[model samples]
Target chain A: MTVLLDVRGLNVTIGGKPVCEQLDLTIEANQSWALLGRNGAGKTTLVHQLAGLRPVEAGRIRINGHDLTELSPKARAREIGVLLQHSSRGFGASVFETVLSGRHPHLSTMAWENAEDHAIAKRAIARLGLDALSERSLDTLSGGELRRVELARLLAQETSLCLLDEPMNHLDLAYQASSLDVLYQTYVAPSRAMLMVLHDPNLAYRACDHWLILLGDGHWRAGPRDSVADPALLSLTYGHPIERIDSTHGPVFMPRTSLEGAPDNHDAAD
Target chain B: MPTAQHKRILVLALFAGLVSLWLATSTGGTAIPATEVLTHLLSNDGSTHDEIVDRLRLPRALSAFAVGGLLALAGAFMQVLLRNPLGDPYILGISGGASAAVLGVMLLGLPAFWHTPGALVGALFSTLLVFGLSRGAGDWRSERLLLTGVVIAAGWSALISFVLSISPPVRLPGMLFWLMGDLGDADRPLLPLLLMSLGLAIGLLRARDLNLAARGLTQAASLGVNTARLRLELYFLGALLTAAAVATAGAVGFIGLIVPHMVRRLGGTDHRILLPAAALLGGALLVLADTAARSVISPMQLPVGVLTALLGVPTFLFLLHRRVRT
Candidate 1:
């Protein structure tokens, strides 16, 4: 199998604090993995380094035999599609223009859009059910709708690897399923790989073939979903006793206590 | 659908521009008929009507149109580059820098070259200074940039006031007239420079990288935009255009801040369309505004800049309200 993304000794820091330390990850083509962590577990920071938004402080990252540090920004953008956690509300771009901006990596300077770019944007928008809102300002969208728009933009990038930070954030129940479904059907089912930061363990188990869980204090474990989904491993990650509950689909987590100083009985109510 | 409205507006502005040009030439201090002015403009004969229409009215009208267009285009570029509605040509102290340089020259009895070259140098210098100070340890901060520009503007305005207060009576009228900003001094030497700046602005309008750069430094860099280089290029282009306009017509204001807002409101905020549309509409709008300045008081003309403020502020406030309501 072709290795799509390879990271060794990766360390990420922001504002003088180490977010992720001594991390190593490898992803192969056609692989789909969920990056599971609690809040502030450095999932976003790790992926940001992979996307080249923030420089990696102490490690080497290679994508398809090309050293990421040596590649120009345009070249890196041509191969990796990133979906940030929350896009700015001030962009004021229309839905179509926002998606079209993803094609910037492929076009030359002073070049006008050709027919192919427009067709790609149209297909991405259609996949997200945003054809009706093609001309509407992005600022007018609800949170879930905005997430789908961002996904469409990633689709427009047409890269081989996706580095998504919390792809399911701000989505409602139905749209949460929809967002994952679309990501699975579009990117994962084919040959491309996806490394997505996920907050919900149930969503992680349901959608991802592989799981990588980051403990609060920088320790992490990664393997196939069945190998990493045990209650003991999850309890070590979230730092509380976790119980499996019966669900129509399968098993799901029920936390015995809140890690953030909430009362123990409140978990049942939640 | 909205494109149809834009086309209608463009046609209306063009028709208004033609009518105002005729009215400006005819209703000057010595009232000539429109037919005679047109005939004089077309003829090579050194007739009395020909001298008035060609030497006096036409240059002033052209200066007003060009300076107005330049300032508006600069403003539109600044607004997009900084991602702030308040970012105009003057927001970064370009006008204050020019004004201070000119005031220093007029007050200190400098050589003849001081007026034009001083203005351009000052405008370019201040743009670089603002760009330098607003940069963070790694990237540019919008709030800091705006604050630094405001500070520079305040300091320069105070210096200009000091110069004006201490100047001798002999140069006071010239200095004060320059400050008031009339289109009365449109000499032949300035026409080529105005055209050059217009060309530069048109070239900048083709920079597609600017669209990506407007979305914050991090966002821009993630999309393969060379954020640092594009920022410097845009600042250079905007400053060059503004300084050239300031050099020609002496501190025209308010057109830059208002015209781009109107364009963004009508044509959408995409720079591919906003840049060109703002330039044309701004030129036509100012031509008509200058006509009103000259014709409303007849023998005693109000300063063209004053008329622009009087017309622009109210419309801007109305647009603000309308935009808020929608």
Candidate 2:
């Protein structure tokens, strides 16, 4: 399989807290990977480092055959599309205009959007079901709607590797399924790959074929979903009791939050 | 960011500007026929109106127009840079620096030619100081830049007052008039007009990138804009335009602060359209204000800055009220 993203010895630290030490990761084409961790696991920081927004402390990242740092900003943008967790807006423009801005890396600074560019933006908007809101101002949209707009922009970007930090933010169950389905369908080729940060293990299990978990304090595990999505490893990482139930559809991972999960353990009562 | 309706409004604004220029030239000091003003504008008829049209009224009116254009164009960029709808060309205290330097030069009994260059130097110095000092340990956020500029502006204001208080009484009248934005010595509009045109061109060329910049710098960078360069463009381009306008007529009020808001309120938010619309609207507003200033008290003019504020405040309020109502 062709490797799309190669990371070697990535030393990620934020505020003197080591996230991972000498982390090596390789994402091949046609793979969907989930980056799983609890809060403060440096998941966002790691994604940002990979997105080229944050500096990589001591590591090398290669996209396709070229060094990530050596690529021009425009070239890198064409290779890696990112969906950040939170977006800040100074002033609002229309949804269509916002989506069209996704094509910035493709055009020269002064070039106007041509027919093909507009068509791509339009298709993205349609895929994300944002056609009705295309002409509406951004400030007028709700949280869920805005997330869809951002997803549409990412779709319009059309990059080979998508680093999506919490792509499920503010999404309802219906949108979560439809949007991820659309995204996976669009990138279901040997030349494209996706890595997303998801909070729910079940969601990650369903959406991704591979799992990478941050165990905190410079430790991590990476492998196929079944190898790394172990109940004991997740319970240790989250500092809680977790139980994996073999459902009719698939195994579902759940935390032991209620009394029924351990009926005899009165010591764990809230 | 743009639509056909925007283009229609641009054409309408251009038409309004022409009529305003005519009104400014024809109705000051002495009432020349409006048709005669048009005739002289079209061709040199060598008539009696030639002295007023070619010499007296035309120069001053064009000076007001260009200064207005410079301020509003700079204002358009400032709003995006600071991410504030109320952002003004003078918000960073460029006018305060210019005023202090120009007043200092006048106090020393320097030749009139020194005022423009002195103002330019002082404005640039203030810009550099804010830029250099506000760049602390982290990102050069707008909040840091704005704070540094406002504080330095206060210092410049203090210096201006000290200069005014200690100036020989004989030079006080000229200093005061200039401070209140006099166009008496603005007989040459060539430089300011050129500066406004150049600024307008750059604003248009980078209009699309400006749309992204308006959203936020991080987002703009993610979209592949060289944000460091764009940030520099915002700072220096704004300072250059403002310094030129202030050099012509010392710190005209209301035009820089209000015209961009007015244009945006009128639905010219796209920088491609907003930049040019602001240039036209701002120019015409100042021309009419200057005309009213000279003619309202006839023979004794109120400061053009005072007239701009008095006229602009009500129009802006009305527009805002209309938006709220609808």
Candidate 3:
């Protein structure tokens, strides 16, 4: 398999706390990887590092055989698109204008969007079901609608690799499924890959072909889903007892809850 | 590309600006008739109107227009940089720094032209100070930059107060007029006009990146915008524009804060349209305000800054109220 993204000896720290230490990762083409970790496990930091927004303390990141540091942010951005956890919406730009901004990586600073750029943005918007909201101001949208608009913007970016901090945030079940479906269909091509931070184990299990689980204190496990999605490893990573139940559809991982006889009367009343 | 509505608004603003410029030139202290004003302006008939038009009112009007345009453009950039609706040229204390410097010059009994250079120096100093302090060994967040500017502005305000309190009574009126944003003393319009055009051109060229920046730094960076470079350029441009405006018109208020917001409400938020539209509207607004400032009291001209606030406050409130109603 051709490697699309390679990370070697990555050392990242936030507030003097070591988040990622001597970590190495290799993502191959046509692979979708889910990043699972507890809160404060540096998921967003890692995403930022991959996107070239944050500096890696000690590491070499190569995208398609080019050193990430050697490339300018704009050049790196052409190969790797990112969707951050939160974005400011105070500018009051319309959806069309906002999505068109996603084409900045492909165009020069002085060049305005051409017909082709507009077509790409329009197709992305249509694919994400944002055509109805194209002219509406972004501030007027609900949280879910805004998330979809951002996803459309990511799609409009049209990069070879996508780094999504939390793709499922602020989305309903329907949108969650549809967004993942769109991501799967659009990005899981011969030369494309995606790395997403997900909180839901079921969605990760169902959608991702590879997994990278970060256990706190500079330890992590990364491999194919079949090799890394062990229930005990996940339980240790999350500090909870996890149980895998095989349903008719597929395997589902859930937190194991202790079932006692009956609760005390006082506890029950409370 | 601007839509039909945007085009219409632009045409209307241009028309209004032309009319306001004519009115400002014709209705000054010596009320030259419009026909004679135009005739002499077109023909250079050596009439006394020629002297007034060429010497006093024309430079003043152009200076006012350029100053207004610069402030508004700076305000628009600041709003995008800080990602706050309330962002304005004065928010970073550029005006405070200039005011303090100008007040100090006045207190020292310096020549009139010295205040301009002094104000420019002070503005640049304050900007560098805020920029340096906000970038201390960590991430460059807009909130931190804003906070640093606000605090530094407060410091400048205290310094201005100290200078004002010690100034002689003879220089008090001049100091007060400058603080209130007077255009009467604006002798040279060329530098401000040049700076205004340069800012507008640069702003238009980078409008798309600015639009991305308005979404946030991370978003802009992810979209291939060199956010750090963009921020640095904006800061430098915004500071330069503010310095030029302050030097030209003594820290005019309200035009910077309200003009961009007004334009955004009328025309959508595309910076390509928004930047030029704000320039035209801002130039028109100030010319009209200056006209009112000179004519309202006849022999005793009110400071243009006071008139801008008086006119801008009610108009801005009306626009906000209308938006809420809609």
Candidate 4:
């Protein structure tokens, strides 16, 4: 299996605090990794670094055998697509126009969108079930609708690697499921890789084949789901006791609740 | 897609612009008949009507049109660069800087044409200052840039007041008239017209990326916009357009702030269409305003900028109210 993304000796700091130090990660084709972290644990920061939006303090990152630093922003965008957490609205562009802008990297600077570009954008919008809202201005869309519109843009980018930051944000349960399903269908092919920041453990567990847990204070663990999804590791990573419930389909994690005055699981374990 | 409707609006704006240009040229303090003005233009006759039409009114009308077009184009680019509806050339302090410099030149009793170079220098200085201040510690957010510009604009306004207060009484009226954006002394219109054309071309070429930029920096960059480069280009282009307009006609207001918004409301948001439409409509609107300014009181002319504000404020408010109601 050829590795599509390689990160070696990575160090990232935000606001003078070290978030990731000496981290190494390698993603092979057809692998979807879920990045799980607490608030302020730098999950979004790491994703930004991967997307080349933020500079790494010390590290080497290569996507598709090309050093990330060597590629211009346009070139980098051709191979790696990112769905940001939030984008400002009120640009007064139609949803179709906004989505079509994703084809910018593929076209020359002065070239308008050709037939293929329009077709791809249309298809992506349809995939996200936003065909009805194609002509609507971005300012009029609800939060969930806007998220889906952004998802369509991400899809239209047609990059081999996708870095999604909280991709399920502002989505209802049905939309969350449908969007994840679309992402899975589109990105789970050979020669493709996806890394997403997800808050829901069960959703991540079910949708992703690998787990990357970021413990606070620049500590992290990464491995295949079977090896890294242990209850103890999950519990320690979140700083809360997590109980795993096994269903016929898969395991679900719930926060461990204790009666008042009772010793917590961490204390009992210690 | 909807090219027919957009094309119709463009045609209508062009026709209206031609009519306004004719009206501005023919109906001034002298009030030559339209047919006589057209015959003089067509026949190249050396009559007094021909002299007035060719030498005085033509240049002034074209200057007004060029200045208005440059300002509106600059405003459109600024709005996209800052991602704010209120973004305009004046908001970036370019106009204030130019006004202060021109006032300084007047205070020194320099030749009339000296104010152009003075305004240009002041504009460049302010652009660099804002650009440098916004780049502190490698933080280049648009909101920070806008705040820096607004604060600097306020500072320039204070300096303009200082210059106005201490100026010799003899130069006060000229200074006041210039500050009110009068085009009476706008002798050279060629440079402004050329710069306006160049600005419009650049706007059209980068319209797609600008559309993406209107969303936000990260969104534009994520879609391969080379956002840093785009932002730099937009900043320089916007400053150049503002400088050209300010140099041509001192500190014209409201046209820059209002024309682009009006274009977007009437036409659409695609910068490709929005930009050309803005140029034509801005030119036409300014020509109409200048005509009203000169003819409304016959020989006693009002400053074109004052008329624009008087005309624009109510129209803008009406548009806002209607937009909200809808």
Candidate 5:
């Protein structure tokens, strides 16, 4: 396999405290890597750095061997598609208009989106099952519907590496399954890959083939699923006692109750 | 990519703008037939009302249209820059600075020629002041920029009041009339019209990137937009346009504040369709308002600034009602 994204010495700091330090990560095509971390583990920051939305400090990130900082914004956008965590509500543009904006990088100054661009945008919208809502304004959309619109935009963007921050946010159970299926079908090819920030370890384990777990205080572990998904290590990383439950399926993680303020495993999923 | 409906709106807006210019020039204190106004505009031949039509009425009407277009374009830029729907040219205190400078020139007994340059200088100075103070370390966050602009505008307001208080009683009515935004003395139409065209060109060139920017800065950056540079461009472009319009017409209010919103309500919010549509519709609206201001009381004209709201509110409500019905 070919590497799509390469990072070296990536340092993630929030409010002067380091969360991840000297982090080296390599994502290859045909692999879905789940980035697991606690609330303040700088997951969003790391994602922003990789997407080149924010300037990377004390690190080097290269997409397809081109230095992230050196690439023009349009060139870089063709390589990395970013799905932000929270889209501002009250987008005044219509669904088709917002999705069409994904073609911004592909267009030159003073040149408009051609018929091919509109057709591609329409196809992406239809893929996300939003064909009927294309003419409607985005402010009228529900959270789940809006997330679908963003996904459609990402599809229209057609970048090689997709950095998804909370792709499952605001999605229902059915939409979640359908959304991952759409992403996997489209991106898990020989020339494209994805790194998603997910909170649920069970879903991450079942959906992804690789793991990049951020332990607190500038430490992380990145490897294939079999070597990195350890019960004791996860327990240590989460600061709670995690029990590995082997059910009818292969395996899933569960946290043990300490009897004080901690809830049982069943309640933990909520 | 403008859709068919957007094209229709654009065409209608252009027609309305032309018709409005004819209406404005025809209905002033010395009334002439609309056909005669059109004939004079086209033939360029001398007639009894030749001075009134060509020299006085035509230039003033064109000035009103260009100033209105400038304010509307500036308003659209401000909305995108600050990410607020209520963004307008006057909100940045550009007009306040112009007012203070013009008042200073009057009170200081300077040559009358200094008023235009003084207003332009003051407006640009206020723009730079807001630009420098807003980006404290190095970022143009909307909340910070908006707050900084609002505070500076308040400062200009205080200065304007102080100048007003100390002014001689002889110049007070003239200054007050100027502050109310009259088009009576604004007979030079060429510069503002040229600036409007330039503004439209630059605005349309950046329209696609502007659409992405409207979503948010981070999203805009992620989608290959140079958000930082775009913010600077929008801030300065809005300031420049506002400065020119204020210099021409002494802070005409409603055209800038409400025209872009009216356009968005009629057309979609895509800047490709929004920018040109705003310029045309805003030009037409201001032309009609200025005509009404001059013609309603005949020899004695109402303040064009006050007349803008008087005409604009009813038109906006009608548009709103029609939008709901559709």
Candidate 6:
């Protein structure tokens, strides 16, 4: 399989704070990877770097063997579709128009709504079960529906690689399943791959073909799903007492919910 | 939902345009009979009525329409590009910059308004200041650009006030008159340049890149838009549009800011439709406003800017209320 993206010695710093340092990762075609991390673990930062939205403090990121640093943003977008951490504001646009914006990377500066663009956008909206709401305002949709619409927008981009930040956040169980299912069934097939930021271990275990768990202290591990085992590893990965058990739904991590409402104890995780 | 509503609003806008046209030409300082007005325009005889109809009122009326359309188009373009509802040439200090240059020429003992290259200098200086503060080659942001424009505009306004305070009394009335704004004293020779600038602005807007641009810079770039290059082009085009409008009518206020918003309310947010609709509606609105200003105090001309401000503030508030209520 061809490698779609390669990140080597990646380091990113924002506002004088180190977010990512000496991080190395690679994504191959036909692969599905779940990026698991706690809040403030640089997951969004990593995805942004891959999408070429952020400048690399130091390192190389290549998409489809083309060096990202060398490629223009427009060119990079043609290969990778990125869904932001949250839905955008100020648009007040309809679902169709929003989805149609995804085709902007493929069309020329003078081209209007050609048949091909509409066909692709329609397919994407159908995949998300948003046909009924295609003409509806995006603002009026539920959180889950909005996420699905945004996902449909990414699918309309028709890129080889998908970079999603917290794709499952704020989604109900049904929507979480449906959203990921649409992505996997339609886009992330044998030829393309996806890298998604996730919070729930069970969701990650169920949906991902590979796993990347970033520890709270900046270190991370990556490999096949089987490598994500070992309670000790998961505990250290989260910097807290995490209990991983085999449930009917597969692997579920039960963090010490006891820590909820507890006084600040930053060093205890060490 | 928005699409259907947008279609309906577009229809309403067309109707409004027709109504505005009739109202604007009818209610003016010298209310000539409709039949006589038409006869004067169509006739070749150099009659006094013909001169008043063709040479005086017609040019002024047309210029008002053109300037209004140009400013609104510019404002709409800026708002979309910057992704801010508040984005306009005046809000961002581009107008202040233009005013400052005009002020300099007016009070600094330069030759009369006839010698002032005020619009271009002012707009360019302000736009350059905005460009410098917002981003370098690779770091542009809408918020940053807006903030920088605000700061620059405030500073320039202060400088203008100081200069005005110290200038000789002889120059004071001209300065005040220029600042208050009027379409009645337009230089007919400048009309061609105004038309060219408006045409150029419309051309730049027709590019597919502008549609992507409305979606924010990162997304636009990702979609293959040359962000920096487009920004430079848009900034220049926006400045040109403002300069043309200022040159034509001497700082007519609020037409640029309000017309775009009003059009968006009726025509949806697609720049393709939005710009044209704004152009028509803006031109119509300003003409009507000017007519109202003249008629309300007949035989004595009102500063068109004062009427625009009075009408604009209330209309804008009503639009805001409608947006919220809807």
Instruction: Tell how far residue B236 is off in model 6, in angstroms.
Output: 3.5
Q: Judged by lDDT relative to the true structure, which candidate is superior, 1 or 2?
A: 2
User: Which of candidates 1 and 2 is the stronger one according to DockQ?
Assistant: 2
lDDT of 3 by residue, A59-109 (tens): 899999999888887888899999888755656788888888888888876
Judging by TM-score, tell me the better candidate of 3 and 5.
Answer: 3
**For all the predictions, what are the DockQ values?**
0.45, 0.50, 0.70, 0.53, 0.70, 0.35
Using alpha carbons, what is the TM-score of model 4? 0.92
Query: Interface RMSD in Å per candidate, to 1 decimal?
Result: 3.7, 2.3, 1.6, 2.0, 1.4, 4.1
lDDT of 6 by residue, A1-270 (tens): 788888899877655666667778888888889988777877887787778877778989888889997886667888888887867544466788888888877765556678888899999999888999998876578878888888888999989899888887668878777888888875567658999888777777788889887775557788888887557877777777888778776777788886678887888866
The alpha-carbon deviation from the true structure for residue A180 of candidate 2, after best TM-score superposition, in angstroms, is 1.8
Clashing pairs in 4: none
Candidate 6 runs further than 4 Å off:
A216-218, A259-270, B1-27, B33-43, B109-117, B124-158, B168-171, B189-210, B315-326
Q: Which stretches of candidate 5 lie over 4 Å from their true place?
A: A89-91, A257-270, B106-117, B124-152, B310-326
What 10-residue stretch in candidate 5 chain B is worst by lDDT?
Answer: B317-326
Candidate 2: clashing residue pairs, number: 0
User: Could you give the DockQ of candidate 6?
Assistant: 0.35
Clashing residue pairs in candidate 1 are: none
Task: Estimate the TM-score of every prediction.
Answer: 0.86, 0.90, 0.93, 0.92, 0.92, 0.85
Rank list by DockQ:
5, 3, 4, 2, 1, 6
The CAPRI quality class of candidate 4 comes to: medium
Better of 5 and 6 by lDDT: 5
Q: Which ten residues in a row have the lowest lDDT in candidate 4 chain B?
A: B317-326
lDDT of 5 by residue, A19-111 (tens): 789989999999899998888788888899899987787989999889999999999999999999988543368899889889989989988
Whole-model Cα lDDT of every candidate shown, in order: 0.75, 0.83, 0.84, 0.84, 0.84, 0.74
Fnat: each model in turn: 0.54, 0.46, 0.83, 0.63, 0.78, 0.43
